[model samples]
Target: MGASLNEIKSKIASTAKTSQITGAMQMVSAAKLQKSENHAKKYQTYASKVKQVTLDLVSHDKGPSKNPMMLKREVKKTGYLVITSDRGLVGGYNANILKSVMSELMKKKNDDAFSVMALGGMGADFFKARDIKVSYELRGLSDQPNFEEVRHIVSEAVKLYQSEEFDELFVCYNHHVNSLTSEVRMEKMLPISFDDVTSTPSLDTFELEPDRDQILDQLLPQYAESLIYGSIVDAKTAEHAAGMTAMQTATDNANSVIHDLTIQFNRARQAAITQEITEIVAGAAAL
Candidate 1:
């Protein structure tokens, strides 16, 4: 009985320790989520303005400009910029994004039809394991990422698109809905779709320095790079949110286990005490 009680006590102690660790992780992830969410929100304003400017440039054009970024060609190869987390314990965050990307890749008739630019260790490693080609990879990003940190990779991706390495590029990530929910989003990033832009009442006029074509030549690539960076920030926010929720769930489960173990310990202790009293009473009667 004592041994059983000791075992139950040990389980209770271990579960309590686990609960503490998970609780701490939950708090840390929540802090990161807040910062990441703020960064994402702030960047969206800049992204919107950039998009508006780019759209205005395209809309004001006299004729179809010969810019490669704005022209669609035969899509012999497709590129995917897949974003995932470097670390685990974020429940299904990485899994969901990776699975969606994999599903899309599986539909391809040949592996040569698509290439990947992985943005996290989890994504890079996943593609490597499956023998999927990862032409560019960036990992170890901070919880709140800055644009400069990702600019090089973004530039490289844009350069590759310009070089016609891939006819189209898509960014795959988890979109943040709320603290408890996120959804997989695969967004097309390249070929500069003019149809998607609804002309805003705000972008009425612009002062062209040289010409609209020259301005587009400079702005289009920067616009594409900004779009990639914005997606990274948004994905990071979703990652942190997922991490916070996962840790919270883990802490709750650990605490529940601790509670159950504590109950078992108490029952064993009570049983031991009752058995001792009954033994003493029987000894007295025998005497």
Candidate 2:
């Protein structure tokens, strides 16, 4: 009885330690999630303004000054810039995004039909393990990523599209709907179409400095880079939220286990005490 009680006590201690670790992780992830959310929100304003100005220029132009990014061509090869977290313990976060990419890849008739640009270590390793070609890869992004960190990869993707390496490019990631819910999303990034731009009624007009075409030549690429950067910010937010929720669940489960073990320990101790009392009473009667 003593041995059993001691075992239950040990289990309770171990479970409580686990609960503490997970609880700490949960708090850290929550803090990161808040920071990521704020960064993403602030970035959206700049991204929207850039898109608006780029589209406005496109709309007002009457000439045949069609930017190459805006023109659509035959899509012989496609590119996927997949975003995933470098670390694990984010419940189903990496799995769902990878699954979504696989589902899209399964649609291709040929193995060489598409290539991938992985933005995180998880995605980079995943694609490489399958012998899939990963043209560009980056890892170890901060919890709240900055645009400069991702600019090089974004520029490379846009350049590849322009070079006709892939006629179209898509970015895949998990979209944060709430703290507890996220959904996988694939967004087209290349062959920029005016139709894809969100339309807003604006009475504002801008006086051109150099020329509309020249400004577009610079603005269009920046706009595409901004799109990629914005997606990365959003994906990071989702990753943090997923991590926070997963840690919270783990802590809860550990605490539940601890509770059960504590109850068992109490019952065993009580049983031992009762047995000792009965033994003493029997001795007294015999005397």
Candidate 3:
């Protein structure tokens, strides 16, 4: 019993150390979550402004004028852009979003309706393992992503859309509402919707130095990139928030485990001491 008590004490100590590590990680993730959340909100504003400007310029009643992204093509194939975290340990953060996207795909008319361009390893591997077609895969992005890193992927997706290769495009990601809550969101990227238009004041309404039509031809693609970039930022915010919460829960669980183990250790030690006293008293009585 003495030996068992010591062993259990050692386990408790090890668990305590692990809990400390997780606690530190929780703090770090909390700080990151704050920054990411702010950035996501700011980017959304910029994206919204861009969308509104584009919509106002292209607000013709007839429809979009020869815009590839706005054109509705026959569905030869579709693309799913799965945005998930590269690493795990964020509770149901990745799983919930992935499952939502998979369930959505399962409901599509064609059994194998879409290919994926995965932004993270988990979703990439998930699609590959399932023999779902994958057009591209990019991973190892930082906690706070900059738009430059993912330009290649965005360009490729845009090119594919322009070439009439993919009739539709979707980005499946988790949107950060707050630290404690997030929602798995699916955004349609191609065949741009009227709702994409926003109400922003900063976009110059009277600046006609470069002519709206020519400027729009160039601005539309950049605006599309902004949407992708904004989504990535939003997804990252959710990831950090989820990670912080998960780590805090892990720390709490570890502390609870240590509490139980310490109680067991104390009982074992007391039992061992009692046994020693009992043996000595018995020996004296026997003498």
Maximum-TM-score candidate: 1
lDDT of 1 by residue, 89-114 (tens): 99999999999989999999998999
Q: Report the poorest 10 consecutive residues by lDDT, candidate 2.
A: 196-205
Q: Give the poorly placed runs of model 2, Cα more than 4 Å off.
A: 62-65, 196-207
Considering lDDT, where higher is better, how would the candidates rank from best to worst?
Answer: 1, 2, 3
Kindly list the per-residue Cα lDDT of model 3 for residues 150-266, writing each as its tens digit: 898888887788777678888889998888899998888877767544543343446664766677679778887888888888889999999999999999999999999999999
* Poorest stretch of ten by lDDT in candidate 3: 196-205
Error of 3 at 184 (Å): 0.8
Residue 42 in candidate 2 has what lDDT? 92
* Candidate 3 residue spans exceeding 4 A from truth: 60-64, 109-112, 195-211
**How close is every model to the real structure, measured as TM-score?**
0.96, 0.94, 0.91
* Quality of model 2 by C-alpha lDDT: 0.89
Q: Report residue 145 deviation for candidate 1 (angstroms).
A: 0.9
**Residue pairs with backbone overlap in model 1:** none
Candidate 1 local Cα displacement, residue 269, angstroms: 1.2
